[model samples]
Target: MPRLRYIEESEKTPQARAMIESAHKTGAPDPRVVSIMTRSEIGSAWVELWNKVLYEGVLPHKLKEMCRIQISVAHQCGYCSTVRSNVAKAEGLTEAMIEDLFRYETSPHFTPREKAALRYANLFKQGEQAIDKDEVYRDLAKHFTDEEIIELGQLCAQTDGVGKFVKSLNVISWEEACEINPKLTEARAEAAE
Candidate 1:
């Protein structure tokens, strides 16, 4: 169970209920997180920002989903790592692709552009210094425009920061995830190095 109580369905504001339902239907935001966030005054706006960033930006939803999952797996957030975006699935993102994400630098599943975005996400989660270097932006420029880079950066920042917060909420513990998928712990260890 989540450390935070989810706002009861009947008690939710109409807007909150709608957002939660949308999150469930779409799958990226995860209804559990949305339900918990709905208890806060900022819930609606945060959901809106999440939707716009993940679904409507110039960057492809598949790319953003890959980055989001990469961060989730690296951080060992079971809840976030397990959630899949329906839109991304429709766009041809598969479980196999996600499984190979950690090896993106050398994986045949990812194109040069996808590799660059995943590398950015990995570095972003590691620390500011890892992503702030000149070489990073130059590599990104080869695969993305300035505007696209901005959107990709936003996706990475939100996923990495909020994913940690969600982990702290005890929605799903790292140990619990390891129990469910032993490979996850191994992958996370590989990601840290």
Candidate 2:
């Protein structure tokens, strides 16, 4: 059960309702989070910004999806981890690729560009103080322009920060993720080790 109450259709503002409907149709963010967020105008705006960053921008949708899922898995937010972007799937992102996310460095499915983005997402998840900013940016520069890097960083920050909040909402916990896919826990554990 969600710790936050999902605003029902009747009570939702028109903007909120529209966002919830669109979120359901898109499938990138399950309607559950949108439903809860649309309760406030600020949250609704946040959802809008999320959509823009996720669905628009210079970065490939599939690449963003890859980074999103990787960060979600690292954070162990079951809700975020389980949600899939239909657009990304249609664009050729596959379960096979996702399965190799924890081992992206050695995965044959990703390109050098994709791997760089994944590496950026991984280090960003580790917290600001933990990263070697100059070295990370230098690596990213080889595969991405400054603008693309900014978008990638924004996506990682958004997922890492909000995913933690969502995990706390009881939408999906690490324990639940372990139940759903034991491999997810195992992969994270192996990564930690």
Candidate 3:
């Protein structure tokens, strides 16, 4: 059970209702969004900002989704890991790639550029200083333009902040959480042969 009650559509404020509807249009409504909706005042602003950050950015949305999933896994945030993984799939990432994400350094599926970004994400998850290291920035610069690096950094930070918040709250139970798509997992396994 969620630590916070999931807000019902009928009881939602107009703002919350709109957000919920938007999420529905995207397919299944995320339970985390519903949990956030319980706090109408904060949730409304958060939802708007979240949408902007995730959807409107210089970096490709697919890369951002991948970064989010990487951060989620590093943080041990089950909710974020599950949701972002699914979003990654919708954005065209292969299941084998996602399954091999943790092994990016050696995974044949990831390109050098992606490996750089994921490495940055891992350092970001480690804390501020890890990202601040000159070596990290140098490595990033080799693959990403300065602007792209900034975008990736911001995405990693935002994902870490939000993912930790949701994970800390214990809003959604393990059973209620979105599981990695079984079909994708099967595909990944078969492809490894």
Candidate 4:
């Protein structure tokens, strides 16, 4: 059960309702949005920002989704990891790629650019001090343009903060949200053997 009441469809403000409907049309509505909807103003703003961050960006959406999953994994946020992993799959990331996320440095699925971005996300998750270092930006620039690096950095930062915030609330587990993808499940099982 969620830590707070989820606002019913009927009880949702028009803006919140529209956002929820949009998300539902895209497939599954994010459970965090539903839980946050109890506070319509905050929920509306949150939905809008989340949409912009995940969707409206110069970077390819697939890369953003991958970065999100990596940040969630680095944070050990089960809910965020599950949701973003599914999103990454939907964006055409293979199950093997998702399973190999922690092994990106040696994973055949990722490009040099992707490995750099993933490394940046992991470093960012370590703390502000880690990300603030000049060496990190220099290394990231070898594969990414300044604009691309900034966009990726923002995505990583947002995922880290939002993932932790939702985890702290304990509103929903990945299991409760039904966010697990069958492909990932199968890959995980295979990797275990």
Best by lDDT: 1
lDDT, ranked from best to worst: 1, 2, 3, 4
| lDDT-better candidate, 1 vs 4 | 1
Per-residue lDDT tens digits for candidate 1, residues 85-124, read 9999999999888878888888899999999999999999
What TM-score does each of the candidates earn? 0.95, 0.94, 0.80, 0.81
Tens-digit per-residue lDDT, 15-125, candidate 4: 766776666654322655444653667756766777777777787777777777766655555566566434545678775676787677888899888888878877887
Cα lDDT of model 3 overall?
0.68
lDDT of 3 by residue, 1-193 (tens): 5566777656777777767767765432264555465467776677677776767777767677767777776665556656643454577887577777777788888778888988888788778988878999899989989988878877887789877777776755333443544433332333233
Q: What local distance difference test score does each model get?
A: 0.89, 0.87, 0.68, 0.68
* Deviation (Å) of 132 in candidate 4: 1.4
Q: What is the lDDT of residue 141 in candidate 3?
A: 88
lDDT-wise, the better of 1 and 2 is 1
Candidate 2: tens digits of C-alpha lDDT, residues 1-193: 9999998878888788889889988897889999888887887888999999899999999999999998898877888988899999999999888889888899899999999998888888888975567888889999999899899988998899888888888777777877877778766774564
* Sort order, TM-score high to low: 1, 2, 4, 3
* Sliding window of 10 residues with minimal summed lDDT for model 2: 184-193
Model 4, residue 138: C-alpha shift (Å): 0.9
